[model samples]
Target: MNGTIHNRDKFLNQIASRLNRPRISSKIQKPKWKYQPQHEVYKDATQDELLAVLEEHCKKIHTDIFTTDLQGLPAVVNDVVANCGGGPVVTWKDERFSEWGLDSVMKKEWPSQQIDVFEWDHTLGEENIDKAENANVGITISEITLAESGTVVLFSDKDKGRTVSFLPKASIMLIPKSTLVPRMTQAAVKMREVYQKTGHVASCINFITGPSNSADIELNLVVGVHGPIKATYIVVNDL
Candidate 1:
């Protein structure tokens, strides 16, 4: 049912013929770099130490950060949702919501407060995009947390649409403590491991750091122009 037809092979052949080369790919060998400082920074930091780095970076990025345990996550989520102007909230249909007791909050607490909840249902098609567009807040669980840049990685799939995080005015990302990595270097290695072992990974992986902001106008900083203006990161300590 895909409407766009790709003449990729023909295009590659044209270039290959012009260059007098075979249209064949060879195995790529790892480059020997003179220096790899990427692996050297925060090389021996523990989870707590990494958390400290994440916190420091979060401050600079103008993101609110909090830490809690499994038992306290529900409360934290409630507080954050309310702070961010309790929804019309859109979220991924992730099982972690139920596992982490957030499902109850969405179903019960928010309803009692007259807040609307919209979960991305794959069957609904483009309706999911509309929901995200109308929602005040969007919530998601971070698959990987990077301390170096204070970033949260969201792996997009059918149930986790890109618009869920992109279209909302405010966003909240939940992080399990164990998912924290020292930096993108470690995060990329984990992703490569997934691809090597499974032969595939998520189609779109997003690395979000705080709210969307730009200083393009007269060097004046403005937030929420392209995406959410408010961003929150809640790290579950004992998850």
Candidate 2:
């Protein structure tokens, strides 16, 4: 039995015994309700306008934003990696990286000892995670980019682990223009559609607005206490 069900049954049985009645096995049901947005602000903004809004919010949160075409992505990636001083780099095993020839570009620009691509079937389990945790730079693709809040959504899977985004000193996300949405509501609807079609959702869905920060102790602000110290989003126009 599920732990929840077993505990519920045990409690119900104890109550029934005290009351001199039989325990019930019926399940409780709750009414389902549809969620309606109170305000649909910027529902009609153009792509350029949305991008501008996203850039403004990103700046407020101290997230660096870079815009480039598909052909320029490799050069942009190279620059970000170079800024990290050529330490261990971790990336997802996404096909988009290969399609954009990032592998070849990294090989040409950096040595083989500097890059580590995470593969799902690899046997280097704990060792691989350690490398990613110590990496100077981590790169991944964003599933959804909410322009309204300057948030990037990532779904973790076997190939795309959550550590790739959280463990590194600096995190870089390559977001395609098509993945950009006007608001978080639209991003949620899109993810719902994906789950409906696939009959499954990722184990973890992370919504990152900017670099990790906390101001809990004595109202002193600290960045990267739990995640990357720096975060960058590269928006590719010609996805």
The TM-scores, one per candidate, come to 0.89, 0.82
Q: What is the C-alpha lDDT of each candidate?
A: 0.91, 0.82
Query: Candidate 2 on 28-88: residue-level lDDT in tens?
Result: 6876658546237777887788889889999888898999987888888888777756557
- CA RMSD of each candidate after superposition: 2.8, 4.2
Cα displacement (angstroms), candidate 2, residue 56, comes to 0.7
What alpha-carbon RMSD in Å does predicted model 2 have with respect to the real structure?
4.2
Runs with alpha carbons beyond 4 Å of true place in candidate 1 = 1-28
Top-lDDT candidate index: 1
Kindly list the per-residue Cα lDDT of model 1 for residues 65-170, writing each as its tens digit: 9999888888999999889878899999998889888877899888888899988999999999999999999998898899999999999999999898879999
* Candidate closest to the true structure, highest TM-score: 1
